[model samples]
Target: MADQGVRTDRLGLLLEQFDQAREMAQVRLTGLGDEEYLWEPVADCWSLRRRGEAVTPRAYGPGEWVLDKGAPDIPASEYAEVARQAAGGMPVSKIAEDWSVSVERVGEVLAFTGTPEPDRTPVTTIAWRLAHLHSCFAGQWEWTFGERRRDPRLLVDFTPRAGLALEAFWATIDRWREDVASVTDEQLDTVGFSQYPYGSDPDDPFIAVVAGSGLEFIHHMAEIALLRDLWRARFPGRG
Candidate 1:
């Protein structure tokens, strides 16, 4: 009975964390406009783009819009090495020979894959960040409650407009909350309760996944809020 009480308390705390994060996110997102949503504070920032405008090797979602996301299996380390070599004025052919990949492949990596270097990481637009946050919640929910599917490409809703995107994100959050609300204490204690493939969810206790999800939400929402403040600072009197 005590164990059951502890589990219930833990679940309740996780749910409350989600509720607080969602409320704060909604407040931060209030009155956001397309211009602010898509604003590029720095050049060549990752953002939501029209279907044909994406420069990434792989983009996601259906409809006329896409997020500038990379393939899940992208060799980020190899791309980072290629980027480092290229930055140091090494010829692509030399880098390719050292890495045993084609010169064209090296060029493709440089063009399509992002560098892991702190200075080279592209600033992401609000739209990109929000889309990422939405995808995280939606993907976990699908794998945890709806289906065991691991493919995020199947989950659409990369809306281009800010208002529509927020609506879609809110809907996802609502669905996730509803699903998680029904999770039993036994489920919380069960390892592999969440089969979310993108992360270590399959090996983690459902309670841990819930806690991690809350942390993810809080950090990303704080980032979005900071970006909003920066935007306001950059362009006085403009949202």
Candidate 2:
């Protein structure tokens, strides 16, 4: 703690909160099979699918932005407006499409952060939600401590299968814990310590980034759990 300025206890508390949220998500995802992982309660309901067709343009309803709304062939104006109105970033499907996951299943959390949301955020599968959590976990760690500076645009294609996705989430968290312990508490007080690209880290303190990430985990983990509850209720026998 040579660089101690703020308080390490604060970081420990943040990690505790982060771990608790992750535990909730893990419990929610327990026993979720392929059917539950990719189940679509509604037509064109967005969920992770068998790579290509499971989450492609062909499956979406008319007027629905293609799953890969950000795809080069699809005009930005098309999905951009949807985001503006939806109060989140581009549609989850669009990000899946860009991942080129034509061979396996995909899952993710909606990018309901800073980006505008879509007019209707499709019901996402557990697989997609897990992927989103883990992906963000990985991205945040890389940017905050690893110096990788991962690009958010590339995340659309970074889908993983179910169990692996969960494992990845913890793996990243573990890595962050090991890496962050040595981060002088004083570093937390310094402005712009995060240096992440997807967020306003350049103008904020490292402590804010740490707290925000913990909140992000808590926020999405609860949402994921709720989706699982709704999914079970929607399909009784499966639940």
Candidate 3:
């Protein structure tokens, strides 16, 4: 059983931080113009190229062979299976790499309004990244919210890309913010609220997971902001 006062305090703090993080992302992205979205501060940094076309230099990590720039909104399990079957033994590190790449691509797409090419070799594009992010978020949320517990290894399939990539990205963050904000003290201390199987305590309270996600949101928001600034500097006047 959880202590009521403590749980309330923690829940309040988590919700506050979640709101702040979303607000920050909104502020950073709101004024961004098209040209500034793809500015690379330095060489070797990847940008979103024409859709279907792969960004140069950076290779698609292990199991990301086929890239679908279209929005399928497929279930997370199916998406994970595809990656597993296609990208044999895709390591966990590759997931992190893809995350970084996706962040960069989204920055590019937001900064510039270019007609991405279709009907080409599917490369990891911004749309793909957004789909992946959404799946991961939904997976995590399912653990924390629905089952209120976690699997040993949370299996999430990252989609190649979806049509509503940008819209979904924004919606995802928004949903996270709302969900976090809605968590009450009762929810926080409820064991099995977080189904993070990797955690030492799978039955840990939801508050802990919310706390971690809040931290992650802040980190990613900063990354997005930095990318936006880089794009702004590179593009100057073009929107």
Candidate 4:
């Protein structure tokens, strides 16, 4: 009942934005310094902590879990504190560098056309990001197809081909664009399944998930780009 031509038009604009953000992220990361990959644009951001750094337990609500904690119903101060605590002082540069290292591994595995290796530690490495992309894609697909009973699952490949970091990130963006492209007005308003189970309401509807995911992608890309910029500034000749 919420479907309308106006809604479709708005979604089209948002989809274009998603593509641009993805592209910009790749552009920013290219030719960045190896050390720059560990730059933190601000304090309390997530980064690769050295060995012995304290690790806090991630908090999640009871019941289902989503990819990210949804908008906090609590006051802004508490929300910011939680996010700050979650970041734990890791730099954006570290995240990019870690991701780049994983890309190198992906390139080798794919180049040799070798068999996929088992995930010894699934969530700890860049493998998590790759698997996250796949899961997000699968979840979006299930939601679009109206299959609410299925749950999104993540699988990791140890040996990845080169350029995979960009490929995986960009591929998800492309899929989202495609999904939104064919989305009818009626479907836009339909409730969809999200990996973020504890954060979302079952009756909330699909449009929210699609838009929220797009926004999440954009935010991540922006962070990546900022890291790249910081790296370039820190080491002027590297790029």
Candidate 5:
């Protein structure tokens, strides 16, 4: 259990992280209207095109700033690697703080990416990133705490307009945050506490799950941000 040997009051740190990630994302997304959300800096860019658009191009990400399966392949995080290499690994509270930084950086890059990659998996638009957040969180929440686990791809409507997508994204994060805040020590120690199917949740400790989630959120959000940079650079001052 995450409660083992640790002080009682701080056991809820992961809950804090969930809140931080959502708030950071919300603040960053506030200023953009539909034009910026859908803008693609280049021809054949892999941004969030309206759904049912022909995939004959298949160059975009299942939503991209590049046309490859993994363009700009997320560079490894030296800080996280070093932290993990440290003796027993980072403390829970520190990991939470790290994720907060990661979330903030995601916003910073969103305001900064100023290049284009028409030849790669294309770029991910703000809409795509928000939808990704919504679908991923909603699926995890359903699997861990709701009835009937289902594939997010099959269940989520990624085609929603940007405004609706943002609304759903925030609401989904709120649901996940509530669930995280309610976790008990037993749940933290229990194997498979989350029951999320994609990863090791079926066997990993709940504390481990908490840690994994931080990395996952940070990495994906960072990728979205870099794509934002790429989009901006491609389009000039519109960035």
Candidate 6:
């Protein structure tokens, strides 16, 4: 009985943390416009992009939008074409001309196997940040309470438009919260309770995962708020 009380208390604390964070983020997100959401403060910032406009080696997400993150092992625009041509017995030189790159560059693209390093992470706009938060919540919820087999990359629907993005993000949060609210004290103490594959949730107690998720929400929401402030400062009187 004592153990049950302690677990219930821990779960309540975790949920409270998330509630506070979500409330603060909601306040920050009010009146955010499309221009402000997609505003890039600096060059080469990571962001959500329309298909074929992404500079990264590969983009993930459904529809016409995707996140700009590198996956060097996955062949991208010219790189994918090069690989296809080479597989079809086309010469490297011919493929190079078709791809508008030197043969050597095509070769390098084919041989590339390194993802972007953490030290080189770029600044992200509000759209990207919000999409990331949405993905994290949606993915965790899916793995924890839904099918538990879907790829996280396919779990979110990214959008270049801010209004739709915000709507979807909040909807995901609601779904996640609904499921999390039902977790029992026994489940809270159960290791592998979350089973979210992208993180260490499987090895940690459910309560810890809940706490860590709250941390992720708080910090990312803080970052999003800061980005909004910076955007407002950069373009006074602008959305």
Greater-TM-score candidate between 1 and 5: 1
Give the alpha carbon lDDT tens digit for every residue of 71-105 in model 2. Answer: 22323224443344234453444443543432122
What would the TM-score be for candidate 5 when compared with the true structure? Answer: 0.60
As a TM-score, model 2 comes out at 0.62
lDDT of 4 by residue, 1-239 (tens): 23653334666766766667766766665654434433445444333333233132331212232122122222322333333422665343332232333434333332443343443321222222333454665555554544554544431121133255346555655765776677776766765333343234233466676677777676655545555555557667774
- Model 5: per-residue lDDT, tens digit, 58-168? 323344122212322212333334244233454433333434335444333334344423332445556655655566677678778887467644445554355766676
Over 4 Å off, model 3? 1-8, 31-135, 146-163, 196-203
lDDT of each: 0.80, 0.57, 0.50, 0.46, 0.56, 0.80
Q: What RMSD does each model have against the real structure?
A: 8.9, 10.8, 14.1, 16.7, 11.7, 10.9
What is the per-residue lDDT of model 6 for residues 1-239, given as tens digits with 9 covering 90 to 100? 56555344667777777887889899899989988998899999889988899878767787788888764332353355456657778777765655445778778877866552334467988988898888889889988999999988788879777888888999999888778889988998898988887655776788888888888888889999999889888888986
RMSD of 1: 8.9
Candidate 1: clashing pairs of residues = none
Q: lDDT by residue for model 3 over 1-239, one digit each (tens)? A: 25554344667767766777777766766755433443445544443444345544432322333223332222332334334422555443433243333434333433434443443333232333333445556657666555644431233332333233445666766766677677777877777666644331244567766777667667655766666665556666655
Model 2 misplacement above 4 A? 1-8, 49-120, 149-160
Error of 3 at 74 (Å): 29
Question: Can you give the TM-score per candidate against the true fold?
Answer: 0.75, 0.62, 0.50, 0.51, 0.60, 0.75
Candidate number with the higher lDDT (1 or 2): 1
Better of 4 and 6 by lDDT: 6
Q: Which segments of candidate 5 are over 4 A away from where they belong?
A: 1-10, 42-122, 223-239
What does candidate 4 score on TM?
0.51
Better of 2 and 6 by lDDT: 6
